[model samples]
Target: MWRVFLCIGLLLAIWLRWRCKNRRLLEMARKIPGPPTIPLFGNALKFMCQPEEFIKVIKDLMIEYGGVFKLWIGPDLNVVVSNPDDIKLLLTNNKTSIKGPQYKYMADVLGGGILSGSGTLWRKHRKIATPNYGRRAIESYTDVFNQEVDLLLDVFNSLPKGRETDIYKYIVQSTSYTVCQTLMGLSKEETMELPHLQYLIDLSPKLYDIVFDRMTKWYLQIDPIFWLTESYTQQKIFKEKLSELSAAVIKHRYKALANSGDKLHLMNSEEDSSKNTQLSVIDRFILSDELDSKELIDETFTVFTSSQEASAKIASFFLMMMAFHPVCQEKLYSEIINVTGKDDKPVTDDDLKRMPYLEMAFKEVLRLFPIGGMLQRTINEDISISSYTIPAGSALVIPIYHIQRDPNLWNDPESFDPERFSLENTKKRPTYCYIPFSLGNMDCLGRYFGAKLVKTIVVRVLRKFKLNSLHNFKNLRTIIAISTTSLDGFHVILDSREKY
Candidate 1:
């Protein structure tokens, strides 16, 4: 029996090797350019450990290879396009042929929701739902945005003046509350604080890094879940618990809508009776009956999963830039003060447009430290560019982070110069190069709202307090997962500007 088992294992190994080698040859025949891959592991070893530098390395590699390059993450073939013309070819001219696929893991976590859903489903959902993030919808939500901003300020106010605190957590909590109230019509405390949601955010990237690093393509194919060994059971539990919370929220929304008569906004009710008498974004989808319960839950979960991390990272970037560049911060504060006086009613939509310096500061921060840093698409059909052919089903990524910093486009790209976005300079720069919110149809839907939220919070905080980095705040490195994060946390000293 032992001899027979050994023979079977050996046969499987030989077959796997043959399969890997054959696919490798076929991929290389396409003549795509990239850094050389090491043996069975390919470029996985070089990439897995230092994810924060992933885009940096990819940008360098693509530049060396001239515009487009092929990289092997085990058996997975990814193509990187850095040149503006090549990117436009993929993201604009052939967007349909190059659909979002690397987002599959995220889509599975979301179950064909707006961000993940493709083709007809994406069109239907995007067409109807995407409008909620429009100018009018964003205007309607200013009251909510202001309310949340005040609450965030309250949280910060409660902290001791000189004590160290995790600004990341504060930003996460603030943005989580804002998204919850805006999208799902729930308060932060009312929403499920399931640990798994956090676990999934923290663990998924680490697992990907591990699997792609340790094993060859043959090993990964044998067991995709192999990376989830005994040491990671805590993460499994967190995911399971979060899944339960998603189901519970869905069930609650369903019952409320069924029992209600008018189907008005559910959150408007100050009384228990009113709480049971309206519809939310959740209710609308549930009543549509087009999505399964699991898909609905995943969709809502996706909002929570994606929004908080990205928003928090963005908020952190906004704060870090302000903290480091006091001149920029002062200019913004003056602009905010001009519109909304101290202790005045929260900022309004009309007020947002008038604050040019604030807008400039935010734009500069986004240009420097974009939330996602890259957008990816996979080819669906063969395409030709500059006499070179790109085969079907090839993975492609747009390094927004690199492009924003490309010295050719902007003068002194590394310098935090808000004036660079001044009317004159912006017109001079390439339109596509500064796309931190992405471009084309698949751009970030909540960008307008998210920007407003960040601006409101920054104005409130900076107006009341002057932020300075702590003495030990040197070497603050970013931990890159789904988003770039300062994992050690943003430690800053706050001095109150004036008494309320």
Candidate 2:
């Protein structure tokens, strides 16, 4: 009887501890302002709209709550962070390394590859894959980038007069070709031979479309309900097609690697320059035998699909910017001409250094239009800031869009001005204030290659053609999806330019 009495006392102690913990967390959450919540649902209903309308909800919340706010999506508490100092603090913290629960939406598409995976899997994959994308590898791929961009221009040249081509369409294709050759180790002709190449290229964007739909609809996030919906069905179809393509690329690369000798050392300069380079992305993993069949498939999907849109959309944004502000465009043109000396001479890695105006303009474009509007991180431990303490297991919504466009961060934040990114002006802002590709621990793996690819393509295109943009910067309606984009297409008129 005495022992039984002691057990009850211990149980009572555990219950009290739990209760106290819950109260503390509640107080912390209440400190941060947010839209009013309803019981059980919380702020979930506010997000139940179309993907286009999804951006509106975020904008509305930013207007009402300012930078640091909180949202209760069911039982989950998501702290919205737009303040640059808080953003820098969280991104650098080891405890905030895990991607938030929302990353689960891409699990079907990216698998446990570097982009979607967290913890051991992510760290392991990153360790093995980092070397393959090093400086030497990216520089060697410049030839491939130049060739692909020139091919893209050839398509533009063939367009009929007054056609007003959607630059997004052709640029997406060009980007695919660049990724295939540079990273996948597949030549242009080899990628073209795949029966479903075009289908997968077109389907990639639609896959993200479905991802955004499922993400916004809170009910469909549940597996029991989601599996019954059309999205799950469509997701399966997308994966099936993606799997078939992955198999072809994998098999070809495997066979090619098998047939070759080690060739790891830099051979004499007298031989083929390619002979000195390191192995491809898949080659490194295959040689190390660190990843299984399933791991390889996931990594492939992560790298291939993610690479398609990020660079394409940025280039498309610059094209529109060029059209909207021709004076800036001419400045870019003159700089490119002065650096390269001739229209036909390929812009080398060396030439890019002298083209500060081009870099400044691209940076400004990125500032005006970040590819990712928000990034979500899961806090693993209690993090205290100047205003409040963020409890463990809560999600963090880092609003990249609001932070870059905030009135406090930039003068004339709405206007399209390349001068804003001039060396003198760029130094005045916080380092985290202008993260087009993001920065710090979870920084984009493809940033260097992506920048090189876009700059090379822009230079090549500008050398031969002048842009006449059809949209105005002030009135252009933009939306956030897997990528932030113009609600309407990037329509432009390309006129032939005088050659050097």
Candidate 3:
């Protein structure tokens, strides 16, 4: 009887300790304003029921709760902020450099690439990958960009004039081809034949949607529960196929390097001044020996996935903008004509620099529709922002979508105006106010490459065709997958400028 009494006493003590800990957490959460949460489940049910309305719900919360607010996602605390000051604090501070839980889903597809890795691994891989985006490297890729753009123009020329069509299809295909050639040295024909590339093309969207669904629904976040679901089974198969494909590519490249011997070294050798036989980015990765096969595969997949998606979205946005605002299109055409001297002439590196109006228009499109609508970080230490205390381990969400469209930041913020990005007006905004490629040390390494690629394609296309839209801009909707994209498609009518 005495032993039984002792056991009961210990059980009661453990229960009290757990209760005290939870009480402290609850007290901390109550300090910040947010939507009313229920017992046990918190806001999980609401989020799960309307995962597609996530961004809209966030925007609505921002209006009600001000710049900083707390949300209880199950037992975890998520502190969301849209103020530029808070964003600067979260992104620039080294303490918050670690990725949030949402990125865990990406690990299945991306492995431990820089996008998903943290600490020493991220640092080491970033050091090795930085050179691929250097000015000289990107400049060498311009030839490939021009060649791909020419192919895209041929496809455009084939389309019947003045008939509405979804331009996103052609843009994604062309950008995918450009990325494969310049980054992996794969031609369009070869890319189509690769079973792994085909698998990724078919399954990536569904996989992203599943990951996002898991992120919003708290109960589905548990590994055991998620693994039992149909989505997990599908994801497992997709990842296996993707890994096999990546492995094959790595082996093929390794063999090619071995066969070429010293020739491979000379191709990337800085001392060798011949531009005619410059190597592709993959050649540099293979020759450097800084990354092992798995690491190489991860980096390549990261670059491939990120660059292809972002470039396609940016190009599609530019096409949509050109269609809606014909006046801007006319001005852009005049500038292109002035620099190139003829519509038929191919755009050169020097010509890309002379088109300032085109740059402004592109900037405007990014501001309104950034590929990444929100950037996330997991707090590693307690921090204060906007006078609110955010505890360690809480998820920090920086809503770039809301901040960029904030009425307080810009006059008539929703209006499509390219002049808003002019040097004088740009200087007036805060540091973190206009981050399409993100900001801080973790900013997109391929920003310059992506910008150049999109501009090259846009310049080439605009020189040949006039973009016009059949649909209303106000009625258009967007869905955020890995990137923000048109909910429907970017339907536009392309007419040859010669006809105009």
Q: Order the candidates by TM-score, highest first.
A: 2, 3, 1
TM-score of each: 0.83, 0.91, 0.89
- Candidate 1 segments exceeding 4 Å error: 1-30, 53-56, 94-101, 187-189, 192-227, 230-235, 264-279, 471-476
lDDT of 3 by residue, 269-312 (tens): 77642342345556666766767777787777776777876888
State the weakest 10-residue window (summed lDDT) of model 1.
211-220
Q: Highest TM-score: which candidate?
A: 2
State each model's C-alpha RMSD to the native. Answer: 5.4, 6.1, 4.4
Q: Please, what are the lDDT tens digits per residue for candidate 2 over residues 1-500?
A: 99999998887787567547668677778888888987556799998876667776886788888878899887678999877887788888888888888888988677867887778888888866775566778888978888888789889889875557789989989999888887778878888876577888887777887776666667977889989988788888888877788878888788877677553232223442334355677666566567888788778767777777888988998888888888988899899888886556666899998999888888887887887777788887899876778888689888777677878788888788888887788798887777766666677788888888888888888888888865577778877775788888788888888532
Segments in model 2 whose C-alpha atoms lie over 4 Å from true places: 1-24, 263-276
In candidate 2, clashing pairs total 1
Better of 1 and 2 by lDDT: 2
Full candidate order by lDDT, most accurate first: 2, 3, 1
lDDT of 3: 0.77
Candidate 1, residue 151: Cα displacement in angstroms equals 2.0
Better of 2 and 3 by TM-score: 2
Q: How many backbone clashes are present in model 3?
A: 0
Candidate lDDT values, in order: 0.65, 0.79, 0.77
Could you give me the TM-score of model 3 versus the true structure? 0.89
Task: Give the clashing residue pairs of candidate 1, or none.
Answer: 196-238
